[model samples]
Target chain A: MIQLIAYLIIIVLTIIFLIKMIPRKLKKSPPYTCGEPMKFEKPETVFYRTLSNILGLKKLQKLSTGNLNDYLLMIFICFMLLLIVLVMV
Target chain B: MLAPYAVPLLICTAFALPVFKNEKLIKAIAILAIFLSLSFVLSSSIEVFNSGTKVFAVSGFKAPFGIVMVLDKFSSTVASLILFLSLMIAAFSSKLVKERVKEFYTLLLLGIVGSLGIVITGDIFNMFVFTEIMNIATYALIGFTAKKEGLEASFKYLIIGSVSAVLMLLAISLLYSHVGTLNMADIISRIDTNDIYLKTIFIMLILSFCVKIAVFPFYVWKPDVISGSLEPVAAFFIGVMTTTTVYVIIRIFYTILGIYYSTWFSIIAIVTMIVGSFLALLQKDIKRILAYGSISQLGYIFLAFSTGLAFQGMYHLVNNAIIEVLLFLSIGTMLMHKKMMEKISMYAFLLGALSLIGIPPLSAFFSKFFIITGLLEKNLFIYAIISGLISIVTLLYYMKIYFMLKQGEKKIYWPIIILIIAVLLLSFVPVWLQIFKGVEVDLLARNEYVSEVLRP
Candidate 1:
């Protein structure tokens, strides 16, 4: 039972991360599309809002002065952290 | 008899290649060398199957102490396939490569030599050395086009490949420290594999190979590498390189480690299949889709292994390699003949993709059917269902290719037609019908493998 729960947790986390990694084109109502109205009113698409918040997708876009290398560095750090967690856990 | 000559001849020819500067002469030499190598591999494979496993010890030393080459069913089958694919690629390359023909052929042959060495070597360290040789040759080959994307892809591949290699080296060093032997059979006999330390090494080694095979999460480097390299080079890497790498994985897990844990392989296989297929659905470029498609196909092969149907895995491995070569070669020809994939190439691509998507009455369908059956036999219903559903994703992506191709002009290529016929013939052949049952029994008897490798 414990093992099953652990597996379920892993699966949920994986899905979340996969959603985060998906390119903006694949995402529905990406942050830029959720603009003016979202600032004052709650978005009708709860899923998009949650994803945006969890992934910090909007913040990254808003702060987008970074180059390709910086993005690559970010990805590398995330990958290393994931690997470490996988191995140690 | 011919099996022993394959590696030496390839290596010698690779070195001899630099002496010639004329492009035609270089291409001819490369083709000749690969043809001879293929002939040797085929002849030796026949001998191996008929008379049982053949062992070739190097420098007058016996097994467990010196390097020995083993020619068994698995190694011979994979080696023959590699050599045949290399031969085709060599012959077809002349039409594609314009400059540095000598370097290209040399690296290509060196890659062949290294892959063959990995297959046949009994010593684990030699396997690592050969892997590095194969990797170096591949890195150079990927950079051969020297476009911006090609160089960047090659550099990225180099970094990822180096990390994998280091992990493998660390695993080897750990095993050596524990068991005090480099010979696979000797180490298998001496080491206590169940120890946590050994298990750690095993995971490390498996992760290293996972990187090579482009399993999920580690597969990020593959699309760029495939897209940046020449079409035929991409085909060879997808088909032959992965075949050899999976062969080593089997060798290590089943033969050397002597441990079976289907759960881990199954989980990873499932993830790889889903992620690969899903991502493939989003790709627009034909080659990138196929590259991602190869990842999904590998997931099937690994899934078979995870179910403990190694014979099925081997069967699917060969089937997938054939499909990959056919697809990539057709794509290459089409690219070379025109800017867009025309009618004939589209037909060729459709045929390959159909086979890949598990259309009935094709070799790929048989392999996949066998794999699913293996999953069912093992009572892995979830995996069986997952595989069944993944085929839909596979079909969708392939249909995307088909619809895209529908827009292109029609023209026929005879070579592709010949490959189409071969694919059909293989689909209908019952050559494996009688043997696979026996193989299923034999693989479960793991002692058979250990005894065969260890017999003094």
Candidate 2:
């Protein structure tokens, strides 16, 4: 049981550290080649404005990215292995 | 009675390390911990030499019902090697480890604990767990130096290591569904009862080992890690840890799975031998050169294990451990360019490389002689010829490194003088005595290892 506690603590701390270490991702700048705007911007200005209005960073994040609760489960597995060994003890 | 002391003492010492503020005190404790561990391993080896196998159940529970530690000729011998190198590394790296001293020693001891657990435990699941513990410590240790390449190598190692862990776990899960027993001996004794599952398990287990050892195509990550790391711990980690995995493969497959299943395992052995040697020849950097050399060396070890020459394989194991560690310690020092340390590591490499390539009379020569002779006795004349050819090729690489070192720009650190002379003495004395005294190590025919382990 104590071993399980220890393993859990280690997992929690490692996850916290790893997250802090991962560099923040930034959006890509429009291509600098040729003076033409990406995807005919003048022709699609209205559509772009509509899309921008509906699909901001928060909306894009909601659509394109999601959390998996990986940290919680990682801790759970570590605790489980620790529990198994402790029980064997 | 001494079984628990190995793990618990290390644990106690590591846990208590934080309370001690003085670096000198921690170094003393680290050295003390490994020395005491070495003493126990040595004593256990003596006991096993006297008897046959030492089997003890944990907490007084019997085998199959509770966890068991088997101190056979095999495990005891490996343990002794582990302690021998580890004690030396602990003593040598003591004053040198500057980063996170407490954590460093703690992880090192923990890594040894995991290795010991992996060797001693009869449970396969426990082996997986111990391997993970070991991987974590080693991965962290690789990054401990805080160098850019060190971090990169550690990350690469982490991903690959994690995959191996998963593969092993999956293999274990599949194995348990059929065998329903985790005790290695129990599994071994009952293995012949199934046919289809037997082969499947062999493939799984072999993949696990090949992945772990990084043999042939699998051996790429090691060079980057070994060559890049500033920590001497990487030297022992490569030297002893990889050796343990190969030994474990032999013990698990041939000893546990029985010879009927293992007879055909030599193909990969031969392939690893050829490929490892081929890559070993093409390296320019000092460490990478030795890295491939270790791979090729693993080839001979695989040959012995596959041929069922357990004792011979083990003799090779010890020889490989000794020669490589000696060479690396010196070479690692040379890489540091501490004046005489430069000449010393290369000179040690020259003599050690001869031993490694199996020239007459050196320790490794005897090991290769046994394997090749064991091969001829098995009537695998082709393998004997191939092994001989590879040894010649390996010798060329050794000579290449020799010439390079002999020709390199002058560096004058002389602590390496003592080390060089030591390697010279070690290389010359034993072989010279054996030749003059006509001391004979009777060459075992094929299947020599099988009979030795089964003998009494």
Complex DockQ per candidate: 0.04, 0.01
Worst 10 residues of 2 chain B by lDDT: B437-446
**Candidate 2 Cα outliers beyond 4 Å, as residue runs:** A1-89, B1-17, B260-264, B338-346, B404-456
**TM-score against native, each model:** 0.82, 0.73
So what's the TM-score on candidate 1?
Answer: 0.82
- At residue A13, candidate 2 shows an lDDT of 96
Interface RMSD of each: 7.8, 19.0
True contacts kept of 2: 0.00
Alpha-carbon shift of residue B217 in model 1 (angstroms): 2.0
- C-alpha lDDT score of every prediction, in listed order: 0.75, 0.64
